[model samples]
Each structure stands twice: as structure tokens, then as C-alpha cells.
Target: MYAIIQKFHSGWAYIALLVLVIAVVNAILGMASKKEFTAKDRKIALFGLIVTHIQLLIGLVLYFVSPLGLASLGQMSDKSLRLTSLEHPFVVIIAIILITIGWSKHKKLTTDESKFKTFSIFYGLGLVLILSRLPWSLWF
Candidate 1:
């Protein structure tokens, strides 16, 4: 069960990251070109949100079940164990919250530019945070 969940988490990370990157790039382009926020644009953002949320759920479950996750929390002196057990999960959760907030804020905005800007800043920041803390050795 742990291996299955771990593999799912690893595989899903690729899709989640890719969708997030696409959404961020799309928002940046929209903001730069001063384009109206169409349904397609909204869909792109929504897809990104959905994938990320799914990834988060999977990650949460994995954290509880995997030995390298919560089980290794006390091994703080070991950099790799500390990262997988604590820092990675914590940072990813914060990033997801930021992405969620960006999505919510975009909905309340009245202007196309405001929506694009909101997504750009929030999603972009979230992406950066995720990238910074990702366990590259494990993933690769």
C-alpha cells in the first residue's frame, strides 16, 4: 500500500506541476497582452486548481503512511529525512493554500487585468515555493 501510494504521489506530481506551470504562463501572457478573461482562461486555472488539490490529498495520505514521511520526523539531523518528513509537506501545504487563495481572489475581482494579476502573483509564488522544497533526489 505504501509503495502504491508513493508511486501515485510521485507520478501525480509531474502532472500537477505541469498544469500549474501552464496556468501560470497562461495568466502571465493574459496579463501582458491585456486579454479578457474568457471561459477557456478560467478553465485553465480551474484545471490547475483541481490537479493541485488532488496532488495535495494524495500527498497528505502518503505523509501519514510512508516511513519517510511522518515516521521520520524525529530524525531532524538527517537532512533528507527531515525534508521528506516535515519541510516538504509543510511547504507544499502552504503553497496549496496560496494557490487556493489566488483562485478565490480571482473570482471576486471585476476586471480581467485584476484576475490575471491575481493568478500570476499567487500561482507563480506557489509554484516557486513548491519547486524550492521539492525532494528532487526522490522524484528523479
Candidate 2:
């Protein structure tokens, strides 16, 4: 069970990250060009949100099953363990919340520029947070 979930978590990471990158780039372009936030733009943002939510779900389950997750909660002395055990999950949760907030905020905005700026600032920061805590050494 742990192995399967771990594999899912690992594989989904690529898809989630790709979608997030696309969303961020799209937002940046929209902001720079002052483009209208059309259906296509909204769909792109939705896609990014969907992917991250899936990742969060997978990670949540993995947290309970993986030894490196809850099982290693007390082994904070080791950096890598510290990451997978606590820092990664905590930071990722915060990042996911930020991405969700960005999506929500975009909907409340009337201006195209405001939509772009909200996504640019919020989703971009979420991406940075995810990148900061990713288990790089274990990824490969």
C-alpha cells in the first residue's frame, strides 16, 4: 500500500508541477500583456488547481502510510528525514492553501489585470514554497 501510494505521489508530482508552471507562466503573460481573462485562461487556472489538490490528497494519505512520514516524526535531527517527515508536508499544505486562495481571489476580481496580478503573486509564491521543500534528493 505504501509503495503504491508512494509511486502515485512521485508520478503525480510531475504532472502537478507542470500544470503549476504553465499556470504561472500564463498568468505572467496575461499580466504583462494586459490580456482578458477569458474562458481559456480560467480553464488553465482551474487545471492548475485541480492538479495540486490531487497532489495534496495523495500526499495526505502517504503521510499516514509512509515510514518517512508520520513514523519519522521524532527524527528531526536528520535533515532529509526532517523534510519528508514534517517540513515538506507542512510547507506543501501552506502552499496548496495559497494556490487555492489565488484561484478564489481571481474569481472575485472584475479586471483582467487584477486577476493576473492575484495569480501572479499568490500561485507564484505557492510554487516557490513547494520548490523550497521538495525532497530533491529522493526525487531522482
Candidate 3:
């Protein structure tokens, strides 16, 4: 169960990150070009939100079940264990929150530029945070 969940979490991250990157890049492009935010743009961002949320759910389950997750929380002397047990999950949660905020805030916005700007800033920050804490060693 732990191995399956861990694998799923690892695999789903690629899709989640890809969608998020697309959303951020699209938002940035829209803002720069002063393009009107259309239904397509909204859908793109929505897809990003949905994918990330799914990834987060998988990650949460893995965090509880995996030996390297909650079980290793007190073993912070080892950098790899510290990342999986503490830093990775912590930062990823915050990143997800930022992404969620960007989604919510964009809906309340009236101007297209404002919507794009909000997504660019928030999603971009979330992406950065997630990337920074990712277990690169385990990935490769």
C-alpha cells in the first residue's frame, strides 16, 4: 500500500506540475499581451487547480503511509529523511494553499489583467516553492 501510494504520488506530481506550469505561463503571457481572459483561459487555470489538488490528496495519503514520511519526522539529522518527513510536505502544502488562493482571488477579480496577474504571481510562487523542496535526489 505504501509503495503504491508513494509511486502514485511521485507519478501524479509530473502531471500536476505540468498543468501548473502551463497555467502560470499562460497567465504571464496573457498579462503581458493584455489579452482578455476567456473561458479557455479559465479552464486552463481550473485544470491546474484540479490536478494540484489531486496530487496533494495523494501526497497526504503517502505521507501517512510511507516509512520516510511521518515515521521519519524525528530523524532530522539525515537531510533526505528531513526533506521527505518535514520540509517537502510543509512547503508543498503552503504551495497548494497559494495556488488555491490564486484560483479564488481570480474569480473575484473584474479585470482580465488583474486575473492574469493574480495567477502569475500566486501560481508562480507556488511553483517555485514546490520546486525548491522537491526530492530531486529521489527523482533521479
Candidate 4:
């Protein structure tokens, strides 16, 4: 069960990251071109958001079950254990919150450029944060 959940979390990370990149790029392009926000644009962002949320849920479950997760929480002197048990999850949660805030803020904006800018700023930041905290050794 642990192995299955771990694999699922790892596999889903790829999809989540890909969609997030796409959304960020799309928003950047939309902002650069000063184009009117369209349904397609919204859908792209929504897709990214959905996949990320799913990934978060899978990760939460895996956290409790994986030895590298909560089980290693007190091993702060070990860089790998510290990252997997504490830093990685904490940063990712913050990134998700930023993404969620960006999505909500976009809904309240009246201008296309503003919406695109909001998404670009928030999602872009979230992606960067997630990238920074990823346990590269474990994933590869």
C-alpha cells in the first residue's frame, strides 16, 4: 500500500507540474499579447489547479504512510530526512495556497490583463516554490 501510494504521488507530480507550467506560460503569453481572457484560458488555469489539488491530496495521504514522510520528521540533522519530512511538504502547501488565492482573486478581477497578471504572478511563484523544495534525489 505504501509503495502504491508513493508511486502514485510521484507519477502525479509529473502531470501536475506539466499542467502548471502550461498554465503559467499561457498566462504570460496572454498578458504579453494583451488578449481578452477567453474560456480556453480559464480552462487551462482550471486544469492546472485541479491537477495540483489532486496531487496535494495524494501527497497528504502518502505523508502519513511513507517512512520518508512524517516518520522521519525528527531527523532534522539529516538533510534528506529533513527535506522529505518537513521542508518539502511545508513549501508545497504554501505554493498550493498561493495558487488557490490567485484563482480566487482572478474571479474578482474585471480586466483580462489583470486576471492574466494575477495568474502569472501567483501560479508562477507557486511553481517556483514547488520546484525549489522538491526532493530531487528521491524522485529521480
Candidate 5:
């Protein structure tokens, strides 16, 4: 069960990150071009939002079940353990929160520029944060 969930989480990370990058790039492009926010743009962002949320749910379950997750919390002195146990999960959660905020805030925005700007700032920050804290050693 642990191995299965771990593999799924690792595999899903790619999809989540890819979608997020696409969303961020789309928003940045839209903002730069001053393009009107259309249904297609909203759907792109929404897909990113949904995918990340699903990844978060899977990660949460893995965190509780994997030995390297919550189980290794007490071994914070070990850098690798520290990352899987605390840093990775915590930072990822924060990133997801920022993404969610971007989604919610965009809904309340009136201008296409404001919506694109909000997504660019929030989702871009979220992507950066997630990338920064990733267990790169494990991935490779």
C-alpha cells in the first residue's frame, strides 16, 4: 500500500507541476498581451486548480501512511527525513493555498488584466515555492 501510494504521489507530481506551469505561463502571457479573459483561459486555470487540489489530497493520504512521512517527523535533524516529513508537505500545502486564493480572487475580479495578474502573481509564487521544496534527490 505504501509503495503504491508513494509511486502514485510521485507520478502525479509531474502532472500537477506541468499543469501549474502551463496555467502560470498562460496567465503571464495573457497579462502581457492584455488579452481578454475568455472561457478558455478560465478553464485552463481551473484545470490547474483542480489538479493541484487532487494532488494535495493524495499527498495527505500518503503523508499519514508512508514511513518517510509523518513517521519520520522526529528525525528532523536528518535533512532528507526533514524534507519528506515536514518541509515538503508544509510548503506544498502553502503553495496549494496560494493557488486556491488565486482562483477565488480571480472570480471576484472585474477586469481581464486583474484576473490574469492575480493568477500570474499567486500561481507563479505557488509554483516557485513548490519547486523550491521538492524532494529533488528522490525524484531523480
Candidate 6:
């Protein structure tokens, strides 16, 4: 089960990240081109939101099952354990929340430029946050 979930999280992460990048880029390009918001734009953003949410759920479940997760909590002396147990998860959760807020705010936006700008700032920041805390050594 651990192997299965670990694999799922590992693979799904790529999809989630890719979609997020696409959405951010699309929003930026749309704003730059001054194009009216379209259904396809909404779908692109929705796809990113959905994939990110899925990844978060998978990660939450894996946190409980992985030894490096809950089991390593309070072991702050060990850098790697500290990261996987607390820092990585905490930062990623914050990033996801930012992305969620960005999506919600985009819906309330009245202008095409405003919507894209919101996504560009918020989603872009979220992606950066997630990238910042990833446990590169363990992941590698």
C-alpha cells in the first residue's frame, strides 16, 4: 500500500505541476494579448485547480502512512526528517491554500486583465513556495 501510494504521489506530482505551470502561463498570455476570457481559459484553470487538489489529498493521506511523515515529527535534530515531517508538508499546504484562493478570486474578477493578473501573482507564488520546500535529497 505504501509503495502504491508513494508511486501515485510521485507520478501525480508531475501532472499537477505541469498543469499549474500551463495555467499560469496561459493566464499571463491571455492578459498580455488582452483577450476576452473564454470557456477554454476557465477549463484550463479548472484543470489546474483539480489536479492540485487531488495531489494535496494524496499527500495528506501519505503523510499518515509514511514513516518520514508523522513518525518523524519532533525529531528536529535530523534535517531530512525535519523537512519531510514538517517543513515540506507545511509549506506545500500553504502553497495549495494560496492557489485555492487565487482560483476563487479569479472567479470574482470583472476584468480579463485582473483575472489573469490575480492568477499570475497568486498561483505563481504558490508554485514557488512548493518548489522551495521540496525534499530534494529524499526525492532524488
- lDDT, residue 94, candidate 1: 95
Candidate 1 residue spans exceeding 4 A from truth = none
The whole-model C-alpha lDDT of candidate 1 against the native structure comes to 0.96
Against the reference, the lDDT scores of all candidates come to 0.96, 0.96, 0.95, 0.97, 0.96, 0.90
TM-score of each: 0.99, 0.99, 0.98, 0.99, 0.99, 0.95
TM-score for candidate 6, residues paired by index:
0.95
Q: Write the per-residue lDDT of candidate 5 for residues 1-140, one digit (tens) a residue.
A: 99999999999999999999999999999999999999999999999999999999999999999999998999989999999999999999999999999999999999999999999999999999999999999999
Per-prediction backbone clash count = 0, 0, 0, 0, 0, 0
**Consecutive 10-residue window with the lowest summed lDDT within model 6:** 131-140
Root-mean-square deviation (CA) per prediction: 0.5, 0.5, 0.6, 0.5, 0.5, 1.0
Return the top candidate by lDDT: 4
Q: Cα miss at 112, model 4 (Å)?
A: 0.4
For candidate 5, give the lDDT of residue 65: 98
The deviation in Å at residue 3 for candidate 5 is 0.8
- lDDT digits (tens) for residues 1-140 of candidate 1: 99999999999999999999999999999999999999999999999999999999999999999999988999999999999998999999999999999999998999999999999999999999999999999866
Model 4 pairs in collision: none
User: Between 2 and 4, whose lDDT is larger?
Assistant: 4
Candidate 3 backbone collisions, by pair:
none
lDDT of 3 by residue, 32-69 (tens): 99999999999999999999999999988999998999
Model 1: residue 45 alpha-carbon error in angstroms = 0.5
Candidate 5, residue 108: lDDT: 99
The runs of at least 3 residues in candidate 6 whose Cα sits more than 4 Å from the true structure, single-residue gaps closed, are none
Q: Tell me the spans in candidate 2 whose CA falls farther than 4 Å from its real position.
A: none
